[model samples]
Target: MPIQTRLFVRFALGYLLLGLVAGVVMAVDPAWRFLWPTYLHVIVVGWLTQLIFGVAFWLFPRASRDRKRGREGFIWATLVLLNVGLVLRILAEPFDLGRAAGPLLMASALCHLGAAVGFTANIWPRMGSGR
Candidate 1:
């Protein structure tokens, strides 16, 4: 596997562990119930989506020579944005951080959206023409 693929997989595994730990904590302590959203997002977006992205990137057809696997920079950006968004959501949502967290949450959402766009742009060309 490529370096990017390895990184993605590693991230997915790490998130999976974190999500599971968070879930267990929430289950064990009712007071921690507010963290459900954080755990859910950590598992879904951080673990599952990232795992899919890594596997898809590894298994998908190669891009044409003209494109060269879309753009390495964009893929890196996607990785960064996705992680940043997840981290922001995890930090901001679970605490009673008050109004200060609003902008952080919004920025997290934008980061996720940007990551999706970046991943799409990088992967589209690899889908190959019907011919």
Candidate 2:
């Protein structure tokens, strides 16, 4: 697999571990129920989505001759943005202390949206022209 694919897989595995830990914590103590959303997002977005992205990037058809895997820089940016957004959400959501975390949550959501756009743009052309 490509280095990027490996990195993304590793990230997914790490998130999976974290999600499991969060699950255990929630199971052990009802007071920690507030972390349910965080655990769910970590598993879904961090683990599953990242794994899909990595596998898709590796398995998709090649880019045109002029481009390498359809703009490697954008892929890198997507990776960074996705992680940053997840991290922001994980940190800010729990400590929201009510409404004080509004800006942080918005920023996190925007970053995640940006990552989705970047990933889509990077992969769209690789779908090929019915060739």
Candidate 3:
């Protein structure tokens, strides 16, 4: 399939995997509270969010190929930022990594946010199906 479609389904499946892994970890080891939260966020925000956004942008209508905003660069950039943020968030401890990783995490979140907004703006106008 197309890059957008791949990203969409790929992320969703990845999120499902992540959720399963997280659930297993939580079940086996009850010491990691952060694990559950981090896992959910990673799946929900990281995988699921990107999956949905990428698919929307991919499937969204465009007047022409030139007008198509679902370019490769946008998709990669969004995916990269989202993964980076999610990885950092999941890797770090709640109390630790505060000194350095916190800012990076924030930056990552911002990047994803910007990409999401851009994705929406790029495709929303193209979609004239309803609103």
Candidate with best TM-score: 1
The TM-scores, one per candidate, come to 0.93, 0.92, 0.77
Off by over 4 Å in 1: none
**Residue 56 Cα positional deviation in candidate 3, in Å, after optimal superposition:** 1.3
Off by over 4 Å in 3: 69-72, 93-95, 129-131
How would the candidate models be sorted by TM-score, starting from the highest?
1, 2, 3
Give per-residue CA lDDT, model 2, range 10-86, as digits (tens): 99999999999999999999899999988999999999999998898888888976775888877888888889999
Q: Which ten residues in a row have the lowest lDDT in candidate 2?
A: 95-104
- Clash counts for all predictions: 0, 0, 0
lDDT of candidates 1 onward, in order: 0.89, 0.89, 0.69
Which residue pairs of candidate 2 clash?
none
Q: What lDDT score is found at residue 30 in candidate 1?
A: 89
Q: TM-score of predicted model 2? A: 0.92
Candidate 1 weakest ten by summed lDDT: 64-73
**Model 1 lDDT at residue 100:** 73
Q: Over the full model, what C-alpha lDDT does candidate 2 score relative to the true structure?
A: 0.89
